[model samples]
Target: MFKNIKSTKTLVKKSLTIFLLAMTAVMFSSVAMSVQSLRGDSALDSKANKAGKHKIDTVEGGIERNFELQPPMIPHTIDKYRISLKGNGCMKCHSEKAYKKEKAPKVGDSHYVTRDGKTLKTISSRRYFCTQCHAPQTKDNPLVDNVYEGI
Candidate 1:
C-alpha cells in the first residue's frame, strides 16, 4: 500500500511538471509570435521610398487651422495602442496641456461629452478610449474618388 501511494505521488508530480512546462512553452511561443509579427518587414516602409515627394499634412496642420477640419494623416503607426488605456501615447502630444505647449491640436470638444449627455469640462471617463472614434491615418490612396460635400 505504501509503494502504491509513493508511485501515485510520483505520477502526480510528473504530470504537474509536464503541465507547467507545456503552459510555459505555449506562453513563450505566443510572445515570440507577437514579436515576430511586429518586427517582420513592412511593405509600407519599403514602398515609402517610392512615394512621391508631395508634402502631406499632419495633425499639426489641423491645429493650426482649428479643429474645423479633419486632421491630416498621422505619420506613424498607432498599432501599439491596444496594450493599455491610460498610455494611449497620442495624449503625449495632443492632450490639452500638450496642445498649449506644442501648439498642436487639442483633443476635440466632443470628447468631453458623457454618454448620458452631460458635458464635462475635461475629457470624460467614457471618452477616454481614444480609438473608439479616432483612427490612425495611413498613406494608402483612397479606393474611390468621390466628391464628399460636407453638410
Candidate 2:
C-alpha cells in the first residue's frame, strides 16, 4: 500500500511538470509570433503618395448615413481637434451653448443618459468620447462595393 501511494505521488508530480512546461512553451511561441507579425510599417503611417496631396473633403453638407444605426460622418476637417483625456475640442462647437452659435448640431440627448436609464445634465462618461462612434470621412473610394441601403 505504501509503495502504491509513493508511485501515485510521483505520477501526479510528473503530470504537473509536463503541463507547466507545455504552458510555458505555448506562451513563448505566442509572444514570438506576436513580435514577428507586428514588425512592419503600420497602415496609418503610409500617406497618400499616389492619391495626390491628401486633402480633407470640406464640402458643406455631410455624407448620407450608410445604414440605420450609422453615426453621421464628420462634415468638415478635424485635423486640429484636440480630442484627448484632458479636453474635447469638439465640445467647443457641439456642446449645448456653442452648437446654436456655431450652427453645428448639438449632441444628441441620449448622450446625457446612463446605461441604467438615469438622465444627467452632462454627457455620460461612456458617450463623452465622441470619435468612438463618429468617424471623419475620407475622399477615397470604397475598397469593396457596399450594397447596403438605409431605410
Candidate 3:
C-alpha cells in the first residue's frame, strides 16, 4: 500500500511538470507571433528602409479633414511653386483677384485678418507662409496601425 502511494505521487509530479512545460511553450509561441514594426524585420535601432516614391496627385474635390479645426492639405504638387519673401506663386491662383478667373478656390477670409483683430486688404504676415499649416497630400499607407478616430 505504501508503494502504491509513492508511485501515484511520482505520476502526479510528472503530469504537473508536463502541463507546466506545455503552458510555457504556448506562451512563447503566442508572443513570437505578436505585432511587429512597420520597418519590416529591422531592429528598432536600425534605420528604416527608404519609402517608395509616388507622384503627387490632386483630389477632384479635396481631402476630407480628419478632425475639426484641422488645417486643409494641399491637393496638388507644390514642387515648382515658390513661397519666398519676394513673392507668393500660390496667390496667382488662390488670391481673390485671380481665383475668379483661374477657377480656383480663394484664400480664406481669416487670412486677411491681423493678430490684433484688424482686417487687411491682403494676407496678414502671420498667415503669409502657407506651408507652415498646410502639407502636400500623399497616398502612402500608414506606417503602423492607427486607431485614431477624430471628432
Clashes of each: 0, 0, 0
Ranking of candidates on TM-score, top first: 3, 2, 1
Candidate number with the higher TM-score (1 or 3) = 3
How far in Å is the alpha carbon of 75 misplaced in model 3? 1.2
Task: In candidate 1, list every pair of residues with a backbone clash.
Answer: none
Using Cα atoms with residue i matched to residue i, what is each candidate's TM-score against the true structure? Answer: 0.42, 0.61, 0.65
Cand. 3 TM to true fold = 0.65
What is the per-residue lDDT of model 2 for residues 17-99, given as tens digits with 9 covering 90 to 100?
A: 99999999998987655552222334556652344344567768677786766778888888798878888899899888899
As for TM-score, the candidate ahead, 2 or 3, is: 3
Off by over 4 Å in 1: 1-60, 63-83
| TM-score of structure candidate 2 | 0.61
lDDT per residue for candidate 1 within 47-122, as digits (tens), equals 3333333333344333222245654335445655452654657676667778888665788776788999888876
The 10-residue segment with the lowest total lDDT in model 3:
31-40
